[model samples]
Target: MNLVPGSEGGFAALHAWAIATAAVVAAGCALVGTLLVVRRMSLLGDAISHAVLPGIVLAVLAGGRPGGFAVLGGAVVAAVVTVLLVQALRSEGGVAEDAGTGVVFTTLFAVGVVLASALARRIDLDPSCVLYGVLEFVPFDTVAVAGLEVPRAFLTGVVVLGLVGAGLAATWKDQVFAAFDAEAARAVGVPVAAVTTGLLAATALVTVASFEAVGAILVVAMLVVPAAAAELLVRRLAWMAVVAVVLGVAAACLGYMAAYRLDTSAAGMIAVVLGLEYAVAAIVAPEDGVLARGAARARLAWRVRCEDLLARLWRADEARAGPPAATGPGDWAAAAWLRVSGRIVRDGDRWGLTAPGRAEAETVVRSHRLWEAWLGRHVELPLDHLHPPAEWIEHHLGADVRRRIEAEVGGEESDPHGRAIPRERGRPNA
Candidate 1:
């Protein structure tokens, strides 16, 4: 097929079918991947993918065709075996977790490879086909259901994805508790082992279904990257799952289009795009992402330092103290910015706060002192220890928490160091 850019006028149906197929596969991978990432068992997903080959080959040899129940059964058995062997090695041989997983899955994969090679003449199985299924040709395979022809692979992916989705929804709470604190979940009789086993089996099924469209190795990318990206974007599990599903589906559609445009493999394109999504999330996500919170904190710290410097400048002018001592680098930069903003003026080499700057400066000092007073009453830290923590926290504390602290402390007049606390809004009554 000659690749073309943009959606052609007649390709709407094709695009819809492709995107629907991709979404089904993406959802399955993301759902399973969420649990894998939460449990820190990502390698287990890899193991199951590799080990399913022999079972699939054996099932085919036993007269089961692709997308048949026999193939799913064989894959499930293979997945369970891989998990059991890894557990046994870890418990008995004292092997490290990764090493045990590596040893078990590689051994099973090797066994499958040998069996498939020996039986190649008698079987229709291809090693390359086992590694990567022909997803592009999936729409060609049709079955009559209710007198209507439907893509068999699409139907299979939907059924399997639905089952996984239902199981996850039903066990959502238990899964969350187990993932957050396995020991606590076990103590509460949450059937942690059963949950883990069920998750692994579902992962195996998802991998099998997706293998036709996404291939074996690339399925790992679908399973981990979206969920991992969502984790960066959200804190709550439900939100994380929701975000992950959306991201996965979007990536699936966009990747397929990109691959078609570039005359590339759809599976490879989706994996590459998913990796890109994760990288973007890592850079731009708030709170924990590399760029977001870091930049926010940097800006906030600079603001605080500037305010402090302005306040110090005002006090220096009032007390007839020479120039304020050189402040920290961030504070110095903030001071320069503040001066440029017309909130401060440079008188010779020394800086002085403008009237507007003095007001802003007072608000910062008031927040700091109120926090110190609150801490002195509520926390048992020493006088000097109180300042450092309050310095960071004073920025985040809202007016409501300040009022609550004031009420708790009976409206203290002075902080631990006997410094008169600044009033809110420069009002004496405050």
Candidate 2:
């Protein structure tokens, strides 16, 4: 398993193993993190990632190999203790859960640091590796398996990933039920407490498995960032978990390669790459993302401007006057668009609605006056106050709702402001 000097194959194998280990461990963290995020326990994941360090150090001190069952057991126990402490502080001492978690995990992490530093010789725990991890050296520690030298960290990661994935899969329904509404789930006979405990244990197991490859500091990024990003990208719990795992694995691979090229810490680079993924996800997510929301707003604004121009021209024609002056850039753009789209035409110095344009303009004006009449009839709003609400709502009314409103207002022919309500044109709203 040792690397020979100037060995290209050896170095390539080493890098592959390291990236594989990171990807596997990242997947495990992402799976567990999905439930954590769904249940709003992401901070608890962060707490457990740091607090498990003390248990790991103690386990190593008690003669457990780094990725052994003994070490995993110790981590689970520490994770349980951390949760219990946080709850106790919340219930008995009236402390906030987040504040209590912060206090407990930091204190335990500090103790682990002191113990690791003090017992460096016996425990052989390096402080630098404890924080940032030594991903570059992961391949160096190999265990012989089936006549091949395999990295122990990679093996541990695979095992942890399988375990966490199976455990979550078996409890997916209950996990979701408990996540969205614990009280309701408890009322319906779900084992909310056991589910929560199992999640905490899984968090510890994955955190410890990732210790040698990505370490405590970067592990939280693997756990929370991918899940958070996936949440933005998908709505279903199953798809969210799948997307989170994919994102985590991608980050691990890309981040490791980037770190190798940059001669930097792979763990730090992986975290950075995860942050970048979240940023991209926030921008491009299907709904509620920055781009999607902005596009929706822009479309609405454009529609409003165009519709306002049409309604204004229609009213001018009704008033037996020339077109209104294009006061703003929006009006100018809208008028030009109307002309280009054959919705309006230039008649000398005035703009006139085309045949189709007059019908569409009548519809807009009809929707506005219908809403205003409905509000005046139902809401008892004053004459002057009706225009603004009706104006804003005119763009949103569909044909079906407009008909219903028209019916509710007893087919009123005029709004409260004495403006005649335009006929419906006997067609669906465009």
Q: How close to the true structure is residue 376 of candidate 2, measured as C-alpha lDDT?
A: 87
Q: In model 1, what are the clashing residue pairs, if there are any? A: none
Give one digit per residue, the lDDT tens place, for model 1 in 1-430. 2234475744555555666777898998898899899889888998888888888889889998666556878888999999998999999999998999989888888988888899999887666656666666666666787997666767778988999999999999999999999999999899999999999999999887787777667888888999999999999889988888888998988888898788878888898899999999999998789998889888876766776687677657656898678746777777778988989988888777787887776666667778888888878888888888777776666667766776777778778888766656634544
Residue 251 lDDT in candidate 1? 91
State the TM-score for model 1: 0.80
Q: In model 2, what lDDT does residue 421 have?
A: 85
Stretches of model 2 off by over 4 angstroms after superposition? 1-7, 427-430
Q: List TM-score per model, in order.
A: 0.80, 0.95
Winning candidate number (TM-score)? 2
For candidate 1, the per-residue lDDT at 131 reads: 65
Candidate 1 regions off by >4 Å?
Answer: 1-19, 325-430
